[model samples]
Target: ARLLKQYQTHLKKQASYIVEGNAESKRALRQHNREQIKQHPEWFPAPLKASDRRWQALAENNHFLSSDHLHNITEVAIHRLEQQLGKPYVWGGTRPDKGFDCSGLVFYAYNKILEAKLPRTANEMYHYRRATIVANNDLRRGDLLFFHIHSR
Candidate 1:
């Protein structure tokens, strides 16, 4: 229960980060475009109808997953992962029948749980757009962590 609560909080923070980051990026882009147009009227001879259309499209797709919805999904995913605790680790495996590698375990647990597909490899997961870099002190249960391991 405590872990679920921590996951819920983490989901809320992540959602807010994505939404706020996108909004700030859009604002910055608009400001930059305005300045560019002001400096070079001939370069932007026509009104920015294309830019408006792109912004409108982005706005239409900006809906974030709700905290309660994600919380329930995370709870289920955690349970699923726990059930696989004693399984053997297999490279590139993603299902219980085949066992799992580290990233494969995560891929099985959360991929498509909320209609979002996770990348197959840890390196890809680390670079995924929605993946945030949380401080070690800020980590909580259900939070996915990535690390760099040098090969000997």
Candidate 2:
């Protein structure tokens, strides 16, 4: 339970970082609404509403952006990955520019290029919701592939 809470907190921080470009700049549920109301008093709903309403308003105001941007983002991400193609593969190394493992390569590309905010471990990334389990024959772009190289 504690570990799950930790991951949830990390996920919230990552989302805040993505939205605000820095997690420290993100305001809490009430704070954001207060700012919005102060900025656009006529546009905001009446004050003293539920906290969830304030939180929802803040979330709805933020944009996830469009898929159109993703293609360009993905191309750029691939370019970064290609630059590391010739580097030596070390098991636990995270430095792709020098050398790193298979997992490290993906981690670097996502965090640097897209700010994808994936899990730190391969096992967690494999099971994460963003990585849908598809049949090998039905594979598509950006799909996370898994191979059973060894058994536990």
Candidate 3:
């Protein structure tokens, strides 16, 4: 019973992360919505109409985005990740007892904190997330950012 409850809790968390990520991605894409459709047919679903109200409704629903909802989730994730940081490194370690590579560390961190399963490579993680192009001044606590480190 306890295990099942934990599994369900994790499932709900992952679901929430996916929804939030999709919401963020959708909002970010709206800036280039028109040009994007013209340039890349393979990147998205069939072109959406400007008159689409469903998207707007979803945005409204997620808008207020109270800090309580976001903050607690992040804290939980971080705590879980911190607990495993000192684990031994392994080639593809994703658990605390084994060691982690750079991407594995990132993947584990996000999975632990965000309940979001990110790709196991930095490049892949960059590509998997929405391209929101956040400026340095606009960064928030949980916002993911990438920096080019001496040509990788």
**Which one wins on TM-score?**
1
Give per-residue lDDT, candidate 2, residue 70: 46
Q: Which ten residues in a row have the lowest lDDT in candidate 1?
A: 57-66
> In candidate 3, what residue range of length 10 has the lowest lDDT sum?
57-66
Off by over 4 Å in 1: 1-65
| lDDT of every predicted structure (CA atoms) | 0.66, 0.58, 0.56
Candidate 1 residue lDDT tens string, 1-152: 56656666765665454323576777775565556444433222244455777544433333222345545676878987898999998988888987999999999887745455778999998997656677889986778887668866
Which one is best on lDDT? 1
After superposing candidate 2, which stretches have Cα over 4 Å from the reference?
1-65, 135-138
Q: Could you tell which candidate, 1 or 2, scores higher by lDDT? A: 1
Clashing pairs in 1: none
Model 2: ten consecutive residues of lowest lDDT? 60-69
- For model 2, residues 51-141, the per-residue Cα lDDT tens digits are 8665655554432232433444455556667778889988876795579888788887666544346666688787765555668898755
TM-score of each: 0.54, 0.52, 0.49
Q: Give one clash count per candidate, in the order shown.
A: 0, 0, 5
lDDT of 1: 0.66
Steric clash pairs (candidate 3):
77-113, 88-98, 88-99, 89-99, 90-99
RMSD in Å for model 1: 11.2
